[model samples]
Target: MNEESNSKGIAMDLLQHFEDILESDPLIDELGFIHPSQFDLLNEESGISCNSFDEANCQSTDKILSEQSSKQENVYFWNKDHKLGISTHILLPLYKDAKHSFLTALKRYKTCSNQSNKDGDCLPASSSCDLESLLMRHSRSLLLLSCDFMTAWNSRKLVVSKKKQHSMFLNELILSGLVLSYSPKSEQAWNHRRWVIKSISAISSNLKDILEKESELVEKIAERSKMNYRAWNHRCWLISYMTREQVIDELKKSRSWAELHVADNCCFHYRSQLMLKIMKDSSCLVETVSFSHMVDIDKAWKDELDWNGTLIKRYVGREALWLYRRFISSCWINHFLTDSGDASHHFKESITNYHDFGTFLKKELCLIDYCSTVVDNEFGDFEAQAMHSASYLLWLKVKVPKPLENELLEKMRVIELKTLVEKSYPERSSLFNYFMS
Candidate 1:
């Protein structure tokens, strides 16, 4: 009984501290406020005291006064900005109130949870309902202050389960989104949102609509903060539920976004994931007399390669674009240009009119030549960006199969490329020599 009374008294004291701080603005101002006239008065006092001293003492007094005057000027300048002190006034009340409320709710929830765990039986329905309401209210309040509060989130989960409030999962989705609005990178909040969505998927029939809106939400968040891997990851998760056509639509929509953010490797990585999904969809492989679906997929792949080439040409010295090129090239070789006799007939037919393996090799070499020329002209010899471009070309020369007609010339070009890079970037000469050998 005394512990309960003591807890209530502590809560009240915390609340009173909040009120006192909120009302102490005038006191804070009085303590901080200084006037120009005060400096004059201090100087006058120093002068008067110096008059009663010897010559040496008077010099020391003057020096001390000058230092004191400088300090006063600095303080006065700092205090002139009113908003500087207002943050403490605003945050003190919020922290005190949030701490008090969070502790109180946590104590009650822990007690209820402990009792249920010990008894191995659920609480009475009415008690469970009341506790659920309490937990929901306080947890929401606490999460608004600190979105990553895992303990509060777990307690709310317990309450929802005890009360069988599965319907509340939708509301939890809304709440999680609200939390994410302020703390977009909060892993705990994002994880909770995923759990809420999964729960709703099991119970609700409108999951398609929910997931579509979720995809839009994630896109908006990604736009606001470029290179947000978490938002991109969530969008990738949404693709599993979407149809092949829907996934393709999303891919086309994100093309411009990815192009604009060429340095963001996450966007490129997400695009690769989407393409993999499309490639794996058996429904997309159904043939038509005039045009096979594989033809359309091939066209998409070609367009992506063209787009990547354009970006690489436009933005010289971007490792991300080079990395994306490698991804596209690897996917192309594995899916369309496989030398294995076991390759699918549909895949071979799709690339019949499109560039064959040799043509693709020539096109990639031409791109490398273009990048090297641009890097040379824009960023002179020995630039690190040039080294990056050279390294990528060297990697391609080794990884890609040589063309039939000019294999010797291609090998000579590779040797020249390595020699030029070795001369320009002597630091990496050893690695370049290893590649050459």
Candidate 2:
């Protein structure tokens, strides 16, 4: 019993200290802490100032300033350890106080949640709405410390549901975005944002503008972190509600990003999804579409193919562009090149369209040959590049007409390609041999 009382007293003291710091706004010199001039010099060296914490108003200014002070002090200690170094142990008490405050708020929230549950009413009564507000404030504090805390997020959702405040839902989005700015890959934070959006959609009518801005935000995040699968997945989810024109606009914008990031398969996969949506749209059906629209679609596919070819030549060892080529080729054969007939007739026409299919295959083969020759003559890793190019040719060979397959798969060339692959990548010799056979 005495130990419990002592623990309670410590928590109370820490809480008092935290509140004091917030209300007093004590300067560094006033607290007998580091000098103001020294703090300014440290901020200059780190290129970050305590004043910057004011801009991130998502959290309490006191906690944010403490964290910033801790970071700057650590950096200063490292840089000045040889001359006038001071121990950074003073910051430990600040962090401990923050942790204590977080835990105290968490405990209070749990108690409030349990009390509401036990009363058989998840929603707080009008008389106890103040309790709900307090719980929400605690949740916000906890989330600022650990954005992935699902329990705190759930509590906030419950509070919002009970309050039915449209403004609160909007504020939740800002909070989640602040979390994302620090941890871009937090699934829980992203999920909370989605929930907030869903709730807002129930009330707001201007969601189209909001979603467009969201798409742009995801694009910026993708640019910072290549191959962010979650961001790409969110983008795909957003496409279901997009208009045909908006989808086409997004497709055009994404083409340059995909070309610049040749090795990121996520962007290529996203492109394939967008293309499928375009092809499957009712307005794009051959009977309903204008001649000009059909011509535009054909031109887009041709341009994508040419772009993929260029990327393949520029980046020799990348397989993502090759995979994208397969997607584009299959889509083109199924939708654009073949006539809109029965499956058997379409299959037959795909093979017999010498003007289109035959020319495409010949051009692709020439590209492969040119790439292989360049790799052999100029690149230091001849065998690896040769193997990559040869594997692509092998894929193309299977797609050719059976009568011309043997002609395309010349025995001497296959043997030489196999020998180079075996020498360069001996670990996969068995797989290579099996494929060759």
Candidate 3:
């Protein structure tokens, strides 16, 4: 019985040690699980091995942890470099205790909050404050151990939101970022981040820096996490809040990353969304639009169209590029070629003045004509190029502005495009014929 009591005492002490470490280090950005043997290896020099959670070993581990705490330092073995590691052996004990404590505090917090403002029905003010603090600390630890716990995350949100403390909201950002450090794809963590942002934006005004930081965070995560659709989706969602100048800046900044990742349709989609936003904003102006900004927008279109052509020529068979072209081409004809210069507003009658759009259509025809003539390679990339080009032209046929609706007939024939598709991709020839004819 003495031995069992001693072990329990050490376990509680170990839990306190972890709590103290977290309290001391608010900058811990990453958390991971480590093997018990590895934890022992880390403590070899201190003459302590936590290979067994038995009473004797537990006592020694607690002593060393105290010594390290007293010394005001912790190295990479368990906590260092702004990262915290948990031993697999103690994971169950630690998680159980942490989660239990968090849930208890959360229940008390809910009770306190549910009580009317009339007063004596709930715990006293001091006690309620302590309960909220306890919930926050416990929820942090629980989330580090298990990020998918929506209740814990939602509980934290409730506490922070009820208090509406700016510092507390910032701390929530740090907490969610820590969760994302390990589980970048955790939808709960990401959603919690969005919630925090929404809450903050409701009160704070100068959010340009905050939005920029969020964009950078997405890019940094995307670098390490491949094909992260959620991250990109979050970035695209941020476009709504950005200033027009910031939108243009984002366009210039994200170009390099997009170029390096030509195949990532999400990134291209992000770019298209940004471009469309600029057009939408320019058109929605009740006042006259900025001439300089309009000129810049025109230059942006020219650069993008030329850049798309260069990318298509350099990297043949990229479906993403073709798709991007279709979007930009549609945007160009509707916004630039039309008289009103607003695609989203309405399509005006500019058919007789289709001189500019007619030229744009000619450029597109030449591109597909070049791609379809390329010889097939071992990977059949040329064939894919032909199919995408053929498809783009066919799509453009139906999508052209109503004003220039019949103008495409004079520039390119549907029969010729179907033949281009059939040349390298005979299998889809009938499908193309059915759609085009």
Highest lDDT: which candidate? 3
Pick by TM-score: 1 or 3, better one? 3
How many backbone overlaps does candidate 2 show? 0
| Residue pairs whose backbone atoms clash in candidate 3 | none
Q: Which candidate leads the pack in TM-score?
A: 3
> Clash totals for all models, in order?
0, 0, 0
* 1 against 2, candidate with superior TM-score: 1
Between prediction 1 and prediction 2, which has the larger lDDT? 1
lDDT of 3 by residue, 1-437 (tens): 66556655655666667777788778888777776456555556546444443331232343232223343222222765577777665666677778877888888777777784555658767888898889888888888888999899988887788888888888887888878877889899888878888888899877798789889988888988988998898899889889999999999899989888888888889999999998888777624655555666767887898898889888889999999998888777766665564432322332223336667778888888888766756767887887788788778878886777677867786337656767756776777656544
Runs in model 1 lying further than 4 Å from the true structure: 1-127, 161-167, 282-291, 339-355, 374-385, 401-416, 430-437
Candidate models: Cα lDDT each: 0.62, 0.61, 0.75
Candidate 2 vs candidate 3, lDDT winner:
3
Query: How are the candidates ranked when ordered by TM-score, highest leading?
Result: 3, 1, 2
State the local distance difference test value for candidate 1. Answer: 0.62
lDDT of 2 by residue, 1-437 (tens): 66555545544443344333323331211111243236456546757554563321111221222234333322212122112222233244433554555556556656767887787665556636666655665565456446777877887887787667887887777667656655677788778877877777777756777678777777877887778888788778777767778888888888888878888898888888888787677333555555556556667777888988888877776778878888887777656544445333433343345236556766676776665653365555445456566666656655554665565555336345665455555677677655546
